[model samples]
Target: MKRICAWCQTSLGEVSSNIHSEQAITHGICDICLNNLFADRDIDFIPFLNSLSAPVILIDDNNTYLSANSKALDVLAKDHQFLKQKRTGDVFTCENAHLEGGCGHTNRCGGCQMLQLINDTYEGKDSFDHVPVTLFQKHGDVRHKLDLELTTEKVNGLVLMRIDSHK
Candidate 1:
C-alpha cells in the first residue's frame, strides 16, 4: 500500500525507524518536525513571529485556529470580521476578486506557490524551510502583490506557521 505524507504528499520512504510508530512518520520528521507541535511549546517563537513585518498565524493541527499577531489581525482579520468567522480561508476571501470568482477556486491561489510549498511539506518531499511565494490580494481598487515567506514547522504538536509579506 502506497501512503502519502500529509505535510508534503511524498511517498512514504522505507521506515528505517518509526518516529510515531502507531501514528506513522516520514523520514525523521512528519508531524513531529519541530520537536514539538503544540501551542504551549511555541512560546519562544512568539517573539520571532511578533517581529515579522507581515502577519503571522500558528495554525493548530485541526486547521481551525491557533495564534496570530497584531499585524496579522489587522491585515488578515480586518477589524474582527475574519476572527468572527474563525477561519483564515473565510477571512481571506476573493469573491469580489476581479480575476477569479473567489480566492479558493481561482488561479490566484489555485495555482499558488504557497500551496505547493505546503504540499511539499505534507508529502515529506521538501524541507518546508524559507520557501518563497507570491500571492494575489485586492487592496481597494488595486490588486496588490504580496510576497509570502512560509515556513511550516511543528511547535508543541501544532504547526507553527509563519507567513511574512515582502515588497
Candidate 2:
C-alpha cells in the first residue's frame, strides 16, 4: 500500500506516519494537512468515521464522546443526542459508570484498561490493535459481560476508539 495523506492524498513518502508506523501500512494524514483538517472551528467527524465499517467512537482528552458514526450509535442502541451527553462508559453501559463519580472519577477507574489505552494513545505512548477487553454491561436490571476487541488510533489529538470485533 502507498503511504499517503488521508486528507490531501499526497504521498507520505516511504514512511507511514499513522499509528501503525512500525508495520507496513498506508492510512493516515500528513503533517501539512493536519492543521487544516482540524482548523475548522466546528470539525465534523461523522463523515470521516462513517467511511469505516466498524463501530468508531471519537473521544476527546477527557474521554467525552464528540461524535460517532451510525455503526457506533447502533452498537449502543442510541442516537447522536444520546452519545453527545454521555461518555464512553455511559455509551458502553459499563456497570461502574453509574457510581457517584461517574465515568473517570471513580475508584474502579484506576484499573480500567480501556481508559489506560486511551491515555496511552493520547500521550503518544504507542498504538494498539485488536486488543481484547472485557466489560460488564448493564441492561435494565441485568448485567452481562462482553468480550470486545479494540483498535485505538490517535488522530489529530483525538482518539478514535474503534471496536474491531466482539463476542
- By TM-score, the best candidate is 2
Model 1 worst lDDT window (10 residues): 19-28
The alpha-carbon RMSD values of the candidates against the true structure, listed in the order shown, are 10.5, 3.0
What is candidate 1's local distance difference test score?
A: 0.50
Provide the overall lDDT of each model, using Cα atoms, as 2-decimal numbers.
Answer: 0.50, 0.75
- 1-167 per-residue lDDT for model 1 (tens digits): 44444444565566534333432112234554334423364354445455545566655443434566677666664643344424334445333334444433456555656545544554567446556876656667677666666666544455545554445
Residue-wise lDDT of candidate 2 within 75-164, one digit each (tens)? 778898877857778878889999989988888888887788888889987668788888888888998998888888776677788887
TM-score of each: 0.49, 0.82
